[model samples]
Target: MEQGRAQNESAELGGNGHDFRPCQSVNFTVHRVGKQGTKLQELDTPRGLACSDTSCFVVDSGNKRIKVYGRRGVMSGLFSSCQTFSVSNSYWDFPTSWSPQDVAVDSSSADGDHVVYVTDLKEKVVRKFSHSGVYCGVFSDQMLRSPSNIAVDPLNGAVIVTDRESRQVALCKPDGGLIRRFTVPGVPRGVTVSPKTHNILVTVEGVSQPAVYTPEGQAIGESQEHENDVLDHKAADLGDLCVDEEGNIIVADRRNSRILLFDPQRQFVGTLLSRKDGLRDPCGVDLLCDGVVVSDLEQHCLFYVRPGVANTSITKPSQ
Candidate 1:
């Protein structure tokens, strides 16, 4: 997940035109073949961002690689040598696909080791791996249909996923056996489950409301309107949901060009950032030690956001 400076610039929103609310001082730099120091993609459209030892693991969707970087967006040698996962076939014995839409890390597989799990959009599968980015394997059986998200349930090593074509969420084992299935409102795009709350949060596409439910699929809240009934959300397209230390939900409101902050109570705290907030079609959103991470699906980059910083300006959050 990536975050940009939440200061400056202008982006149109719902009924009321607004800019981004300054969250904190945040920035990012691209580290690629010719993009050292500062060379960044025109849009840096990354699909997912994972955290490891204060560094960010970003997946470049348009391209076919995953990268690791420091908090300042500096290049770290974590996923530089990582290969692409395919959809129709396998490469280097790894999975293949058209897009790497989402990823999850199995932090508790073996003594808190970081294992990466990526959801190949076109492949409709999730590939698991160890922290070293090894070709562990894929979790596919004949049940998935265009899966958009993946997460490893620490409870029983169940791999949870949400499918777009099926408009439902399915649970599976590493071997790809059907664990359970549940129906959702619409085409669920982004999904997140918290061990503490044992609840899964889903961001539905074409729907302004995000649904929060218990592990058993009981309703907790909906993202239709704010508690005060103010800010009417218009097609949130919540690409990512991150639960913080306090279980607060940091939603990457993709279409809105801003990140929405919600407490575990499902109350809208306020706007985190916007196009002016250094956000550009932010897709993957997750939390790390001291801040939030966002993946720019349009720029192929990972951005960082410190929730407690003084000022975050995104007039040009790019490298």
Candidate 2:
């Protein structure tokens, strides 16, 4: 049993000289974490990145398919939800068009464990599926338009999708209820969620953009690059983002061909990887178990980094 632990305890002890109260509260404890592996598995679809049931998931743009990898970066299976079936031949239904840019998994599902979610970019909808590549359902709320990226609030399973051309983000319930549509100041590209927090981060191609979000869709942080004529922030065009175990942020600074690590305060810590490290046009990033999985969009290859070990490469979007 844990209670709210007061912050700034020294203020409580010497508050006689001034008006004092607990400024903040912190909770510490253990939790049942889903496992994810960091092994460098073969690569496919170096585009949409998500974690479904503690495993790394990707929508390989080039392959026109999705791939699953376990916590240790073991190849699990290929996503076959979008199948071709003639109405007169097979008993299946699919959207008129299916083009996936990003994928997500519903973390709150209890039925058909490992339920996966993906954005149908061309169809302007979000499609739902099972971990085994079965067509589960579809989310076509009126709010969705050119949906590109998908993220889910693991706590409540709220679905978040980004529409690249529209420069907006849509929030919906797992059952396909439209909650809200948010306008991102810049052209938003990739997006991510922090499991330990409800805050969502989005990458934008706008000049000086970093990430902007609020609990209720308000812009929290503006683009950090090009503050003024004085000094340019010069981080890079952020395309993908992920939070590591230590709550540190890993950003794929695309155009600059580098990846950056930032503290919780959104302050730049350092470059985690770069083109000098054999990264080329690194667009999407997902941190698996103890290693990092990176997608080089231009090269169509997947690269994994392990401590003290050489990085291994796999052909992009393997069939």
Off by over 4 Å in 2: 1-45, 71-97, 110-112, 207-209, 227-235, 309-319
Using TM-score as the measure, the top candidate is 1
lDDT agreement of model 1 with the native:
0.58
Model 1, 1-319: lDDT tens digits are 3333444312211100112223333342221221222223222357766665345556666555555444443222223333333322333323334477777766655676666777776666677656655667776636888877776665566677898788888877666788778878777877777656657778776655468766666667555632334335354556777664345666787777777776666556666666765556777776554445667665555555543333433222224
Candidate 2 per-residue lDDT over residues 71-91, each given as its tens digit: 322333222222212112232
The lowest-lDDT stretch of 10 consecutive residues in candidate 2 is 9-18
Question: What lDDT score goes with residue 63 in model 1?
Answer: 52
Error of 2 at 86 (Å): 15
Global lDDT of each candidate = 0.58, 0.58
Local error of candidate 1 at residue 265 (angstroms): 1.6
Question: For every model shown, what is its TM-score relative to the native structure?
Answer: 0.73, 0.71
